[model samples]
Target: MKCFEKLVRDFITSSLPASMNPLQFAYRHNRSTDDAIAHLLHTTLTHLDKGRDLSWSRHTNSLAKKARQCLYHLRRQRDFRLPSKVLQNFYTCTIESILTGNITAWFGNSTKQDRQALQRVVHSADQGQEDCEGPHPSQQ
Candidate 1:
């Protein structure tokens, strides 16, 4: 858990804005469970884009930060809490590792346009994975 926390924390600290707060965002989705994660990210980004002084700013937390919040939302109560830093560490250590260093290209580019292009590549890479993996024979 410590390693997990460390990786996620680092990722959050660096990937997010230096002056941004992670706990003032909220996300909602028409479909629960499957779309929850993406919804959270979208909401957070939107909140940040709207600035911190928005009326809704006081009522939210970053999706990663919320993982440690009330757990009874969709199911059983969550007994453990993980902070933004820890969550960043976990993501970096786990899924970030899977990026095999491509994440550097995704975020560390010299220009905003370059970064955006890299983001498209990442998106395409993600979509490609779904096609590549397909459905299991058992499901057919």
Candidate 2:
């Protein structure tokens, strides 16, 4: 467990359903599109809450940058490894965090497809591949 993972876990779990048992997926390691979306949401929230004086635009942009960077690392590096569950945890939390960081805009809004689309672009660019039919491995 990395420090970033812990921070995300503490922050996201504090507000999410206790029964969600994010840790339970430890053995089922995978890094799918849905996982990424979930991570972005959670991370965006955590970053917004913890990142001092950061505006919504900056927070979202920063997350996007991080997501892109992770994609690049995952594809270009052989040892760029992380537990599937851990990465899934990170991705879901980050996604939720970024979206809801803006309390004013989080009131019953939706961006599932939009976020997935962004992830697709990042994944494709990093892998030099076309659209993935389903969830990705838990490597990136």
Candidate 3:
């Protein structure tokens, strides 16, 4: 078994690009005494756990930053007021696209905290739009 593991490691070292770091993840219920089985890489990989869970905080934070920038730019335009429909369209194209990008790939595997953070970003964007438009006729 050790010989096979060594061969596999040697093959990987020879085949993979130098820029890529080789990482080993042990997903065992019981801890193993063998250090080679779960050796840590020199540089830790970001946004991935041993259980293959993705940390989506970076992605969500990027989306929020982009959305905020778009909102600020839209609000700063003083030449003419953008119609509500146009504003909504812009938000959907710029912000919603970022939020939903690759969602199918990661959403199912995301932790509850990650999902809640994403939800907050969407909710805040919605609230910001309402605030920008002022009170609706029905509410007033």
Q: On residues 5-108, what C-alpha lDDT tens digit does candidate 2 reach at each position?
A: 87886676576655655634432336355565666676776677685643344444565666566555444332345444544454445543543454444332
TM-score of each: 0.20, 0.26, 0.50
CA shift of 114, model 2, Å: 7.6
Candidate 1 lDDT tens digits, 15-58? 66555444434222133443555556557656765755322221
Candidate 3 local lDDT, 1-140, one digit each (tens): 99998787677657755554323323222434353332422123332465675466776667667766666655543125667677678778877887788675556556677778777767766666677688766789
By how many angstroms RMSD does model 3 differ from the true structure? 12.8
Each candidate: what lDDT? 0.40, 0.50, 0.62
Error in Å for residue 6 of model 2 = 37
Each candidate's clash count: 16, 30, 0
- Between candidates 2 and 3, name the one with more favorable TM-score: 3
Rank list by lDDT: 3, 2, 1
**Model 3 TM-score, 2 decimals:** 0.50
